[model samples]
Target: MLTTRIRNVDTDAQADAGMQSLNEPDFKALVDSHPKAIMLTAQDGSIAYVNDQFERVTGYRQEEIVGHNPSILSSGMHSREFYIDMWQSLERDKRWEGLIWNRRKNGETYPQWLNIYPVEHEGGAFYTGVFMDVGELTANDERLAALAYYDPLTELPNRTLFQEFLKARACQREPADRCFAVLFIDLDFFKSVNDLHGHDYGDRVLKQAAVCIQGVLRKGDLVARLSGDEFAAIVELQEPSEINAVCERMASAFRKPVSVDFREYFLSASVGAALYPRHAESASDLLLKADRAMYAAKTAGRACYRVYSAEESEQGQHQQMLSEALVASLKVAPEEFSVMYQPQYDLRSGAMVGMEALMRWRHPELGAVSPGEFVPLAEQRGLIHELTEQLVRCITRDLTRHDFGTHGNMRLAINISARQIADDRLEVLLEPFFTRLQLAGWCPELEITETHLMNLSPRCLDKLRDFGKRGVMVAIDDFGTGYSSLAYLHALPVHVLKIDRQFVQRLGPDSRDSRIVSAILGIADALELEVVAEGIETEAQKAKLQELNCHRGQGFLMARPTPLESLVRQATSG
Candidate 1:
């Protein structure tokens, strides 16, 4: 509403009187005293009168604006069709309410919620427009849209946005012109980064990785973070070679170091690609093929890319089914899973000093499934945390039920997943296990791979150090197979090293494995760490390991991985 002098006319009261009841003088006063921004435009769209509020909102004097067309305040933000539609609504309904961006006399553009209503007078017909500022509302709408479609950490388009983009592009073209590529990328060893450095550093690495990915793509291509550590891209393909070049550039971009917290961390990513028309017809299928190809790249030893193939797609589908089944099974019937203990013998004493608990799965319909098959799948699906918890609970219950720990004082060796160690609540989870073991007079050792140790973040290192202080023996399993620096190995809070089977399998006089074994034993001796030789299948291997003073050994020759009942009988009988 406007507030300005209107000669002797009561324009404010006249407007409230619907203009018909008021004389010209009363109409003038009525329009002048109104509080809203009210502008009266003649039938031809020329400005008839503007109230004080109109001049205040537009920063124009009434005399300067009154003689001009309402177009003088146009922000140039709307198209001709917009005005055509607005007039259509005004004519049909007598009033139209909408938002418009208009420029002020100071050249600043702002949004306003405007209403246009027809006004009839004895002389002629006119329209009165009432408007108020709504710039903040416009900004809030944009902010809500961004929060819905973007990843907060990376600020890249998220899965919901990516799907919308794919849908829009698919509908924008004919089938023949629908040629594009979808590349699914998974960061390698990213979990280790989270485990070692902390999630904040991991998030920084992901943000940098997103930027690197965007830098490599063509101008029209779309890159998005599908989820944590997984990114997807939509690329326009010209020649088939373009996909290869783009993938190479993507991998190269990720190969660089990401500096976080004053430390530089190197990372690698595996890419899987699916080409439109060639790989599949739909965006969902294309994404699926690309995901399968990505898993194939992981299977081929990582740091590479693979194009979709029928074989890889089949295998990927099977793996996905298994992953889903694992998630469902964990929720519905985890007790359907079981643990078996493999005896670990002391070569010098010829006695069972410990047993390593191994997970075994037997589905009601799928029959027996190897831990090798399902464990990694669970890790991929983020079910490993639950699986590990179930495993500890089962093993602890078995130990308590059989009284095996008291029977032979046999130590229980449990393999720990990186996810378990990274969990903030790991101390609480392990409290029961430690309490039960202490009551049984048996100490439990946690086995971790040498590779898992190599990437220990400072946080992971500190957590393991704390666990070690609590008297849980930390042993490195599959030692020789992983590349770990002596500096890192010496600094680790480890009490034992289990020589990998590949190294122990070749144990003989003057062999390379023998020399490596001797060196490992010497390092262990200097560090006051115990050494265990794994996969010793013969008396000859055992004798050779004993000659090198290896403290312990385990393999099929001692006993196969048996059920808890069998392990209990053996321990109690001994």
Candidate 2:
């Protein structure tokens, strides 16, 4: 059921109706009326006639194009070889259909779908080409590419594009001729900002950070956003000597405050780096090594950078193995993990007021593994949440069994990590545990490090405030060790400040630390906050603290961390 329409086509029917052959006027009328951009060319490639569509699409008039070569539309996008091959195909097959970039009379370049057919007529043989603009399709393809390989927020290269670029660079270059470095950067306290303000604010910060990073890098270098608060870069190095300066430059850029939405935020980054061929042979391995080094920088207390070493690589692998074993241990035998309470005493009363619950792990082969060694690794490996949950459950169970609350109603202190604070489920995780561990209304105090507090976002603060409303006490641990500002200190809802062990260990008759401790104690007194001195192993330190009017303290000299039974017995007997 196809219908046919015969217009001005130069067919046999047209010859039978009055025209013996197509004259110049008939050809011109037909070509001009055609919808497509049709062009008639001589066998020598000279233009003969053009349709109205051709004049409109190419911005060329019939007189301007009729006698000249079609090379006037050449855009220079295709090379000589391309045109030569195209002409060869047309000559061999007598037709050509392909995509081409052409120049218009208005000096603009555009893409077109072109079809050329060779035909022999009464006067001569000519090639007739018909083309349609395909510019929108080309633009759509580019947009799709951008969406596929670029981050929408920052407009930077994302992980997928980064991996492809790394692979390309790795394969195309000779290892000996050039060396490249992969740097992994993790922004400190970024989670707190994201949680406090809003994701929109966090996005603004990330985009600004990306710009800052790009500003510090060289022209050929590539920067990419790997994930949340984490970015990676590929730096082309002329020599190994250039890496230190480059890393330093990168770290210094964030030293300036980033202003977004009328709020200024200070950012510190931990940068880890690995070089090409020396540290790894593959792109994935290079990135992994850089990540390991970056975590090492974070462990070194952040706001720093570290270069990958063979020793660190070995340690990283060992840490990974330990992390796997730790995960398995959580499920197989939960009882193997234990929490010991370290007694904190009132200096004036000579009685225990509270106990800090410290987590201890015992591996069958590794013996007793210190919390310092595995805690950060667990945090990095995304095991901190699980570890914290397990610890809370264990401690609550032990507290109920000991009935320490009934004996003396002493407060319990547990450490909380930054990751835990940033977790949206933190309140949900601890609610049931707190409900079970209820010793009337005596709430356990949660000890958060100073760094964790300074970095807490509004959301985290809100969560902390919720805990406070439930009678939970918030204590800042290792008080003087982090970047705490008066602005935050005045607004933070905190109960206790634990003086860092370093300042306490140096306490003496007239040492500089004595004055520092005095100043910290004075600050605490002014703020009406209770102070606790940590790491007191000597009587002199305790006497000095007492002399300074610091009433509460904890140390190995008083009593080493012990199990629930021992702690309960001590509390009952004394």
**Top model number, TM-score:** 1
CA lDDT of every candidate: 0.78, 0.78
Q: Give the TM-score of candidate 1.
A: 0.68
Model 2 C-alpha lDDT per residue in residues 3-82, reported as the tens digit of each score: 01112434545333322233458666877787678987654446767788888899999878875878788776555555
Off by over 4 Å in 2: 1-178, 184-214, 222-233, 253-270, 277-288, 325-333, 378-383, 418-424, 431-443, 455-470, 482-492, 571-574
TM-score of each: 0.68, 0.64
Q: Give the TM-score of candidate 2.
A: 0.64
Candidate 2 whole-model C-alpha lDDT, 0 to 1? 0.78
Stretches > 4 Å off in candidate 1: 1-179, 186-209, 224-231, 257-268, 295-304, 405-408, 571-574
lDDT (0-100) at residue 187 of candidate 2?
Answer: 88
Clashing pairs in 2: 196-458
